[model samples]
Target: QSYIFYGPTMSPFTAYLIIRGISTLEIRIRQQEKNALKVAQFLENHPKVERVYFPGLDSHPQRDLVKKQMHGTGSVLSFVIKGGYAAGETMVNNVELVTLAVSLGCVESLIEHPASMTHSELSPEERKKSGINDSLIRLSVGLEDAEDIIDDLKRAFEKV
Candidate 1:
Protein backbone atom coordinates (compact mmCIF):
# COMPACT_ATOMS: atom_id res chain seq x y z
CA GLN A 1 0.00 0.00 0.00
CA SER A 2 1.07 3.57 -0.65
CA TYR A 3 0.30 6.57 1.50
CA ILE A 4 0.11 10.23 0.69
CA PHE A 5 0.55 13.01 3.21
CA TYR A 6 -0.82 16.53 3.13
CA GLY A 7 0.11 19.43 5.37
CA PRO A 8 -2.40 21.45 7.31
CA THR A 9 -3.63 24.62 5.66
CA MET A 10 -3.73 28.03 7.31
CA SER A 11 -7.22 28.53 8.71
CA PRO A 12 -8.84 31.37 10.57
CA PHE A 13 -7.71 29.96 13.91
CA THR A 14 -4.09 29.73 12.78
CA ALA A 15 -4.23 33.24 11.39
CA TYR A 16 -5.66 34.53 14.64
CA LEU A 17 -2.89 32.80 16.64
CA ILE A 18 -0.19 34.32 14.46
CA ILE A 19 -1.75 37.80 14.53
CA ARG A 20 -1.96 37.70 18.32
CA GLY A 21 1.85 37.51 18.70
CA ILE A 22 2.89 39.91 15.96
CA SER A 23 3.05 43.09 18.03
CA THR A 24 4.99 41.57 20.93
CA LEU A 25 7.20 39.57 18.64
CA GLU A 26 8.07 42.66 16.65
CA ILE A 27 9.12 44.53 19.79
CA ARG A 28 11.23 41.66 21.11
CA ILE A 29 12.88 41.09 17.74
CA ARG A 30 13.87 44.75 17.47
CA GLN A 31 15.49 44.56 20.89
CA GLN A 32 17.27 41.38 19.93
CA GLU A 33 18.64 43.05 16.80
CA LYS A 34 20.08 45.89 18.85
CA ASN A 35 21.63 43.52 21.37
CA ALA A 36 23.11 41.36 18.62
CA LEU A 37 24.83 44.34 17.03
CA LYS A 38 26.32 45.39 20.34
CA VAL A 39 27.58 41.87 21.03
CA ALA A 40 29.02 41.64 17.53
CA GLN A 41 30.91 44.87 18.05
CA PHE A 42 32.31 43.62 21.32
CA LEU A 43 33.42 40.33 19.78
CA GLU A 44 35.00 42.17 16.84
CA ASN A 45 37.21 44.06 19.25
CA HIS A 46 38.08 41.10 21.47
CA PRO A 47 41.56 39.63 21.11
CA LYS A 48 40.30 36.02 21.17
CA VAL A 49 37.98 36.61 18.22
CA GLU A 50 39.64 36.40 14.82
CA ARG A 51 36.61 37.71 12.96
CA VAL A 52 32.89 38.36 13.31
CA TYR A 53 30.23 37.95 10.65
CA PHE A 54 27.17 40.07 11.21
CA PRO A 55 25.64 42.27 8.58
CA GLY A 56 25.07 45.05 11.09
CA LEU A 57 28.86 45.55 11.33
CA ASP A 58 30.57 47.80 8.83
CA SER A 59 33.14 45.06 8.20
CA HIS A 60 30.54 42.78 6.61
CA PRO A 61 30.89 42.80 2.83
CA GLN A 62 27.15 43.05 2.29
CA ARG A 63 26.54 45.74 4.90
CA ASP A 64 25.34 48.17 2.26
CA LEU A 65 22.84 45.62 0.99
CA VAL A 66 21.68 44.91 4.54
CA LYS A 67 21.05 48.63 5.08
CA LYS A 68 19.01 48.79 1.90
CA GLN A 69 16.92 45.69 2.59
CA MET A 70 16.32 45.56 6.33
CA HIS A 71 15.32 48.08 8.96
CA GLY A 72 17.34 46.15 11.57
CA THR A 73 19.90 43.39 11.42
CA GLY A 74 18.80 39.97 12.63
CA SER A 75 19.93 38.51 15.98
CA VAL A 76 22.25 35.74 14.78
CA LEU A 77 26.01 36.24 14.47
CA SER A 78 29.08 34.04 13.98
CA PHE A 79 32.73 34.49 14.87
CA VAL A 80 36.01 32.68 14.54
CA ILE A 81 38.07 31.97 17.65
CA LYS A 82 41.81 32.49 17.57
CA GLY A 83 42.74 29.09 18.98
CA GLY A 84 40.70 26.88 16.66
CA TYR A 85 38.32 24.08 17.68
CA ALA A 86 39.77 23.53 21.13
CA ALA A 87 39.23 27.16 22.10
CA GLY A 88 35.75 27.16 20.64
CA GLU A 89 34.91 24.11 22.71
CA THR A 90 36.30 25.67 25.87
CA MET A 91 34.30 28.87 25.40
CA VAL A 92 31.03 27.06 24.75
CA ASN A 93 31.59 24.69 27.62
CA ASN A 94 32.39 27.48 30.04
CA VAL A 95 29.54 29.86 29.29
CA GLU A 96 27.22 29.99 32.31
CA LEU A 97 24.53 32.46 31.27
CA VAL A 98 24.50 31.68 27.56
CA THR A 99 23.24 28.16 27.10
CA LEU A 100 25.30 25.91 24.86
CA ALA A 101 22.86 24.65 22.25
CA VAL A 102 22.46 24.06 18.54
CA SER A 103 19.08 25.72 17.95
CA LEU A 104 18.36 29.41 17.48
CA GLY A 105 15.71 32.11 18.06
CA CYS A 106 14.89 31.16 21.61
CA VAL A 107 14.00 33.42 24.53
CA GLU A 108 17.35 32.69 26.24
CA SER A 109 20.77 33.24 24.74
CA LEU A 110 22.57 30.30 23.04
CA ILE A 111 26.08 29.65 21.74
CA GLU A 112 27.55 26.75 19.76
CA HIS A 113 30.60 25.61 17.87
CA PRO A 114 29.30 24.81 14.44
CA ALA A 115 32.45 22.99 13.34
CA SER A 116 32.53 20.48 16.18
CA MET A 117 28.82 20.31 16.92
CA THR A 118 26.45 21.15 14.07
CA HIS A 119 28.74 20.25 11.17
CA SER A 120 30.85 17.59 12.81
CA GLU A 121 29.79 14.86 10.45
CA LEU A 122 31.55 16.64 7.59
CA SER A 123 35.27 16.29 7.05
CA PRO A 124 37.57 19.21 7.79
CA GLU A 125 38.02 19.96 4.12
CA GLU A 126 34.27 19.93 3.51
CA ARG A 127 33.66 22.17 6.49
CA LYS A 128 36.41 24.51 5.37
CA LYS A 129 34.99 24.69 1.84
CA SER A 130 31.62 25.57 3.34
CA GLY A 131 33.27 28.40 5.34
CA ILE A 132 32.82 26.64 8.65
CA ASN A 133 36.27 26.49 10.23
CA ASP A 134 37.22 24.50 13.30
CA SER A 135 37.22 27.67 15.39
CA LEU A 136 33.93 29.10 14.19
CA ILE A 137 31.26 29.85 16.79
CA ARG A 138 27.65 30.75 16.13
CA LEU A 139 25.61 32.80 18.58
CA SER A 140 21.90 33.53 18.68
CA VAL A 141 21.30 36.57 20.82
CA GLY A 142 17.91 36.43 22.49
CA LEU A 143 15.85 38.59 24.86
CA GLU A 144 18.40 38.47 27.69
CA ASP A 145 20.05 41.65 28.98
CA ALA A 146 22.83 42.70 26.60
CA GLU A 147 25.38 43.36 29.34
CA ASP A 148 24.72 39.99 30.96
CA ILE A 149 25.20 38.26 27.68
CA ILE A 150 28.42 40.10 27.01
CA ASP A 151 29.69 39.25 30.47
CA ASP A 152 28.86 35.62 29.87
CA LEU A 153 30.98 35.73 26.73
CA LYS A 154 33.79 37.47 28.58
CA ARG A 155 33.82 34.78 31.24
CA ALA A 156 33.77 32.08 28.62
CA PHE A 157 36.69 33.72 26.85
CA GLU A 158 38.68 33.48 30.05
CA LYS A 159 38.36 29.71 29.79
CA VAL A 160 39.71 29.83 26.25
Candidate 2:
Protein backbone atom coordinates (compact mmCIF):
# COMPACT_ATOMS: atom_id res chain seq x y z
CA GLN A 1 0.00 0.00 0.00
CA SER A 2 1.04 3.58 -0.65
CA TYR A 3 -0.07 6.71 1.17
CA ILE A 4 0.44 10.44 0.70
CA PHE A 5 -0.85 13.44 2.62
CA TYR A 6 -0.86 17.08 1.54
CA GLY A 7 -0.44 20.07 3.83
CA PRO A 8 -2.76 23.06 3.73
CA THR A 9 -0.32 25.46 2.07
CA MET A 10 2.76 23.60 0.81
CA SER A 11 4.41 25.71 -1.89
CA PRO A 12 6.51 23.88 -4.46
CA PHE A 13 7.71 27.17 -5.98
CA THR A 14 9.09 28.36 -2.66
CA ALA A 15 10.87 25.07 -2.14
CA TYR A 16 12.38 25.30 -5.61
CA LEU A 17 13.62 28.83 -4.95
CA ILE A 18 15.17 27.80 -1.68
CA ILE A 19 16.91 24.86 -3.34
CA ARG A 20 18.39 27.27 -5.89
CA GLY A 21 19.69 29.52 -3.10
CA ILE A 22 21.97 26.89 -1.56
CA SER A 23 25.23 28.60 -2.56
CA THR A 24 24.38 31.93 -0.91
CA LEU A 25 23.03 30.09 2.11
CA GLU A 26 26.29 28.16 2.47
CA ILE A 27 28.38 31.33 2.46
CA ARG A 28 26.29 32.82 5.26
CA ILE A 29 26.53 29.57 7.22
CA ARG A 30 30.33 29.57 6.95
CA GLN A 31 30.54 33.11 8.29
CA GLN A 32 28.14 32.27 11.11
CA GLU A 33 30.22 29.24 12.09
CA LYS A 34 33.38 31.34 12.27
CA ASN A 35 31.71 34.01 14.37
CA ALA A 36 30.16 31.42 16.66
CA LEU A 37 33.49 29.74 17.35
CA LYS A 38 35.02 33.07 18.19
CA VAL A 39 32.23 33.94 20.57
CA ALA A 40 32.40 30.50 22.17
CA GLN A 41 36.10 30.93 22.82
CA PHE A 42 35.47 34.33 24.32
CA LEU A 43 32.85 32.95 26.67
CA GLU A 44 35.05 30.05 27.65
CA ASN A 45 37.58 32.47 29.08
CA HIS A 46 35.05 34.78 30.72
CA PRO A 47 35.12 34.93 34.53
CA LYS A 48 31.34 34.78 34.91
CA VAL A 49 30.84 31.85 32.57
CA GLU A 50 31.02 28.50 34.34
CA ARG A 51 31.06 26.41 31.19
CA VAL A 52 30.67 26.64 27.44
CA TYR A 53 29.21 24.01 25.13
CA PHE A 54 30.37 24.36 21.56
CA PRO A 55 31.35 21.47 19.30
CA GLY A 56 34.11 23.58 17.76
CA LEU A 57 35.84 24.05 21.08
CA ASP A 58 38.75 21.82 22.04
CA SER A 59 37.15 21.16 25.39
CA HIS A 60 34.08 19.55 23.79
CA PRO A 61 34.35 15.79 24.18
CA GLN A 62 32.97 15.13 20.67
CA ARG A 63 34.97 17.85 18.95
CA ASP A 64 37.05 15.38 16.94
CA LEU A 65 33.98 13.49 15.75
CA VAL A 66 32.18 16.68 14.89
CA LYS A 67 35.13 17.95 12.85
CA LYS A 68 35.35 14.65 11.05
CA GLN A 69 31.66 14.43 10.14
CA MET A 70 30.59 18.03 9.62
CA HIS A 71 31.85 20.69 7.22
CA GLY A 72 31.94 23.14 10.10
CA THR A 73 30.41 23.53 13.53
CA GLY A 74 27.01 25.25 13.44
CA SER A 75 26.43 28.78 14.74
CA VAL A 76 24.92 28.02 18.15
CA LEU A 77 26.46 27.63 21.61
CA SER A 78 25.32 27.38 25.22
CA PHE A 79 27.01 28.50 28.41
CA VAL A 80 26.27 28.32 32.06
CA ILE A 81 26.48 31.57 34.03
CA LYS A 82 28.12 31.73 37.45
CA GLY A 83 25.01 33.24 39.07
CA GLY A 84 22.65 30.57 37.73
CA TYR A 85 19.11 31.46 36.61
CA ALA A 86 19.14 35.07 37.75
CA ALA A 87 22.38 35.80 35.91
CA GLY A 88 21.05 34.16 32.78
CA GLU A 89 17.97 36.36 32.92
CA THR A 90 20.04 39.46 33.50
CA MET A 91 22.36 38.72 30.60
CA VAL A 92 19.52 38.09 28.17
CA ASN A 93 17.76 41.28 29.22
CA ASN A 94 20.87 43.44 28.99
CA VAL A 95 22.14 42.28 25.62
CA GLU A 96 21.57 44.99 23.00
CA LEU A 97 23.00 43.34 19.89
CA VAL A 98 21.76 39.86 20.66
CA THR A 99 18.00 39.83 20.75
CA LEU A 100 16.36 37.76 23.50
CA ALA A 101 14.29 35.51 21.23
CA VAL A 102 13.66 31.79 21.03
CA SER A 103 14.02 31.26 17.30
CA LEU A 104 17.41 30.48 15.70
CA GLY A 105 19.31 30.50 12.38
CA CYS A 106 18.41 34.10 11.63
CA VAL A 107 20.52 36.97 10.18
CA GLU A 108 20.70 38.65 13.59
CA SER A 109 21.97 37.19 16.83
CA LEU A 110 19.43 35.59 19.19
CA ILE A 111 19.66 34.38 22.80
CA GLU A 112 17.37 32.63 25.24
CA HIS A 113 17.33 31.00 28.64
CA PRO A 114 15.89 27.58 27.96
CA ALA A 115 15.10 26.73 31.56
CA SER A 116 12.84 29.80 31.84
CA MET A 117 11.82 30.38 28.25
CA THR A 118 11.80 27.33 26.00
CA HIS A 119 11.55 24.46 28.47
CA SER A 120 9.93 26.22 31.40
CA GLU A 121 6.97 23.88 31.31
CA LEU A 122 9.20 20.99 32.27
CA SER A 123 9.83 20.28 35.93
CA PRO A 124 13.27 20.97 37.37
CA GLU A 125 13.99 17.26 37.49
CA GLU A 126 12.90 16.80 33.89
CA ARG A 127 14.93 19.76 32.68
CA LYS A 128 18.01 18.54 34.50
CA LYS A 129 17.53 15.07 33.06
CA SER A 130 17.55 16.64 29.62
CA GLY A 131 20.85 18.41 30.48
CA ILE A 132 19.26 21.83 30.71
CA ASN A 133 20.05 23.62 33.96
CA ASP A 134 18.83 26.91 35.36
CA SER A 135 22.07 28.64 34.48
CA LEU A 136 22.11 27.60 30.81
CA ILE A 137 21.92 30.39 28.23
CA ARG A 138 21.73 29.52 24.55
CA LEU A 139 23.28 31.84 21.99
CA SER A 140 22.67 31.74 18.25
CA VAL A 141 25.51 33.67 16.72
CA GLY A 142 24.50 35.48 13.54
CA LEU A 143 26.20 37.24 10.64
CA GLU A 144 27.64 40.01 12.82
CA ASP A 145 31.27 40.81 13.50
CA ALA A 146 32.71 38.40 16.07
CA GLU A 147 34.14 41.20 18.19
CA ASP A 148 30.79 43.03 18.24
CA ILE A 149 28.99 39.94 19.42
CA ILE A 150 31.63 39.35 22.11
CA ASP A 151 31.35 42.97 23.20
CA ASP A 152 27.59 42.64 23.53
CA LEU A 153 28.01 39.58 25.73
CA LYS A 154 30.65 41.35 27.82
CA ARG A 155 28.33 44.27 28.53
CA ALA A 156 25.52 41.92 29.45
CA PHE A 157 27.78 39.96 31.78
CA GLU A 158 28.75 43.17 33.53
CA LYS A 159 25.10 43.80 34.30
CA VAL A 160 24.82 40.29 35.65
Candidate 3:
Protein backbone atom coordinates (compact mmCIF):
# COMPACT_ATOMS: atom_id res chain seq x y z
CA GLN A 1 0.00 0.00 0.00
CA SER A 2 1.12 3.68 -0.62
CA TYR A 3 0.00 6.95 0.95
CA ILE A 4 -0.37 10.34 -0.84
CA PHE A 5 -0.62 13.73 0.87
CA TYR A 6 -2.21 16.81 -0.76
CA GLY A 7 -1.17 20.40 0.05
CA PRO A 8 -0.67 23.71 -1.80
CA THR A 9 2.85 23.91 -3.23
CA MET A 10 4.74 27.05 -1.99
CA SER A 11 7.42 26.94 -4.70
CA PRO A 12 5.64 29.17 -7.22
CA PHE A 13 4.91 31.91 -4.67
CA THR A 14 8.43 31.71 -3.28
CA ALA A 15 9.96 31.96 -6.74
CA TYR A 16 7.86 35.00 -7.58
CA LEU A 17 8.86 36.74 -4.36
CA ILE A 18 12.52 36.04 -4.96
CA ILE A 19 12.40 37.28 -8.55
CA ARG A 20 10.50 40.46 -7.55
CA GLY A 21 12.95 41.33 -4.82
CA ILE A 22 15.93 40.79 -7.10
CA SER A 23 14.47 43.06 -9.77
CA THR A 24 13.83 45.85 -7.29
CA LEU A 25 17.25 45.45 -5.78
CA GLU A 26 18.95 45.62 -9.16
CA ILE A 27 17.13 48.81 -10.16
CA ARG A 28 17.88 50.58 -6.87
CA ILE A 29 21.51 49.47 -6.91
CA ARG A 30 22.00 50.87 -10.40
CA GLN A 31 20.39 54.16 -9.43
CA GLN A 32 22.53 54.32 -6.32
CA GLU A 33 25.68 53.70 -8.34
CA LYS A 34 24.87 56.49 -10.75
CA ASN A 35 23.97 58.85 -7.94
CA ALA A 36 27.13 58.06 -6.02
CA LEU A 37 29.37 58.70 -8.98
CA LYS A 38 27.74 62.03 -9.66
CA VAL A 39 27.93 63.08 -6.03
CA ALA A 40 31.55 62.01 -5.72
CA GLN A 41 32.48 64.04 -8.76
CA PHE A 42 30.65 67.03 -7.35
CA LEU A 43 32.23 66.83 -3.95
CA GLU A 44 35.71 66.07 -5.20
CA ASN A 45 36.26 69.69 -6.17
CA HIS A 46 33.94 71.37 -3.68
CA PRO A 47 35.59 73.96 -1.45
CA LYS A 48 34.27 72.57 1.81
CA VAL A 49 35.44 69.01 1.16
CA GLU A 50 39.13 68.84 2.07
CA ARG A 51 39.32 65.42 0.47
CA VAL A 52 36.83 63.08 -1.13
CA TYR A 53 37.78 59.43 -0.61
CA PHE A 54 35.60 57.82 -3.29
CA PRO A 55 37.51 55.47 -5.58
CA GLY A 56 35.81 56.89 -8.65
CA LEU A 57 37.87 60.04 -8.28
CA ASP A 58 41.05 59.67 -10.30
CA SER A 59 42.77 61.81 -7.71
CA HIS A 60 41.83 59.44 -4.90
CA PRO A 61 45.01 58.08 -3.31
CA GLN A 62 43.87 54.45 -3.68
CA ARG A 63 42.30 54.74 -7.12
CA ASP A 64 44.84 52.42 -8.71
CA LEU A 65 44.43 49.73 -6.07
CA VAL A 66 40.66 50.20 -6.16
CA LYS A 67 40.60 49.52 -9.90
CA LYS A 68 42.30 46.18 -9.36
CA GLN A 69 40.57 45.10 -6.13
CA MET A 70 36.98 46.40 -6.27
CA HIS A 71 34.03 45.93 -8.55
CA GLY A 72 32.61 49.37 -7.75
CA THR A 73 33.41 52.48 -5.73
CA GLY A 74 30.27 51.94 -3.64
CA SER A 75 28.00 54.67 -2.23
CA VAL A 76 29.87 55.72 0.87
CA LEU A 77 32.91 58.05 1.15
CA SER A 78 34.48 59.96 4.00
CA PHE A 79 35.41 63.63 3.73
CA VAL A 80 37.18 65.86 6.20
CA ILE A 81 35.39 68.99 7.28
CA LYS A 82 37.27 72.24 6.68
CA GLY A 83 37.35 73.47 10.27
CA GLY A 84 37.22 70.10 12.02
CA TYR A 85 34.66 68.71 14.49
CA ALA A 86 32.62 71.82 15.08
CA ALA A 87 32.15 72.38 11.34
CA GLY A 88 31.52 68.72 10.64
CA GLU A 89 28.79 68.38 13.24
CA THR A 90 27.24 71.59 11.98
CA MET A 91 27.17 70.28 8.43
CA VAL A 92 25.56 67.02 9.54
CA ASN A 93 22.82 68.81 11.45
CA ASN A 94 22.11 71.36 8.70
CA VAL A 95 21.43 68.87 5.93
CA GLU A 96 17.71 68.70 5.07
CA LEU A 97 17.37 65.63 2.85
CA VAL A 98 20.25 63.52 4.12
CA THR A 99 19.29 61.80 7.36
CA LEU A 100 21.77 61.73 10.24
CA ALA A 101 21.90 58.04 10.98
CA VAL A 102 24.24 55.11 11.16
CA SER A 103 24.83 52.30 8.68
CA LEU A 104 25.20 52.22 4.90
CA GLY A 105 24.03 50.31 1.77
CA CYS A 106 20.54 51.81 1.96
CA VAL A 107 18.50 53.50 -0.78
CA GLU A 108 18.16 56.55 1.45
CA SER A 109 21.15 58.81 2.15
CA LEU A 110 22.65 58.64 5.65
CA ILE A 111 25.24 60.69 7.51
CA GLU A 112 26.87 59.37 10.63
CA HIS A 113 29.31 60.50 13.27
CA PRO A 114 31.63 57.53 13.19
CA ALA A 115 33.51 58.88 16.19
CA SER A 116 30.29 58.63 18.17
CA MET A 117 28.38 55.93 16.29
CA THR A 118 30.39 53.15 14.66
CA HIS A 119 33.62 54.06 16.46
CA SER A 120 31.99 55.02 19.72
CA GLU A 121 32.45 51.43 20.88
CA LEU A 122 36.19 51.99 20.68
CA SER A 123 38.21 53.88 23.24
CA PRO A 124 39.49 57.36 22.34
CA GLU A 125 42.99 56.04 21.71
CA GLU A 126 41.68 53.22 19.53
CA ARG A 127 39.49 55.56 17.52
CA LYS A 128 42.41 57.95 17.00
CA LYS A 129 44.68 55.17 15.81
CA SER A 130 42.00 53.86 13.46
CA GLY A 131 41.75 57.30 11.75
CA ILE A 132 38.19 57.86 12.94
CA ASN A 133 37.78 61.38 14.24
CA ASP A 134 35.16 63.98 15.00
CA SER A 135 36.13 66.03 11.97
CA LEU A 136 35.27 63.28 9.51
CA ILE A 137 31.79 62.86 8.04
CA ARG A 138 30.78 59.74 6.18
CA LEU A 139 28.08 60.00 3.56
CA SER A 140 26.08 57.10 2.16
CA VAL A 141 24.84 58.34 -1.17
CA GLY A 142 21.24 57.45 -2.09
CA LEU A 143 19.13 57.03 -5.23
CA GLU A 144 17.80 60.57 -5.17
CA ASP A 145 18.21 62.80 -8.23
CA ALA A 146 21.85 63.87 -8.27
CA GLU A 147 21.10 67.56 -8.61
CA ASP A 148 18.72 67.61 -5.68
CA ILE A 149 21.19 65.80 -3.49
CA ILE A 150 23.96 68.21 -4.44
CA ASP A 151 21.68 71.14 -3.82
CA ASP A 152 20.91 69.84 -0.36
CA LEU A 153 24.61 69.46 0.32
CA LYS A 154 25.39 72.93 -0.96
CA ARG A 155 22.71 74.40 1.28
CA ALA A 156 24.01 72.51 4.24
CA PHE A 157 27.58 73.60 3.60
CA GLU A 158 26.44 77.19 3.33
CA LYS A 159 24.98 76.91 6.82
CA VAL A 160 28.12 75.24 8.10
- Which numbered prediction scores highest in TM-score against the true structure? 1
The TM-score, computed over Cα atoms with residue i paired to residue i, of candidate 1 is: 0.87
| Cα lDDT tens digits for candidate 2, 1-160 | 9977665774899888888777599899999999999999999999999999999999999988998898899998999999977888888999999899999779789999998899999998999999999999999999999999999999998899
- The candidate with the higher TM-score, 1 or 3, is 1
- Tens-place lDDT digits, model 1, residues 17-39: 88987858989899999999999
- The digit string of per-residue lDDT tens for model 3 on 20-89 reads 8887986787778788888888888789888777887888888899999987777887788788767887
**How accurate locally is residue 55 in candidate 3, as Cα lDDT from 0 to 100?**
81
Candidate 1 residue-wise lDDT at 23:
57
Q: Write out the backbone clash pairs for model 3.
A: none
Worst 10 residues of 2 by lDDT: 2-11
Whole-model lDDT per candidate: 0.92, 0.92, 0.83
lDDT of 2: 0.92
State the lDDT at 120 in candidate 3: 76
Work out the TM-score per prediction: 0.87, 0.87, 0.81
Provide the lowest-lDDT 10-residue window in model 1.
2-11
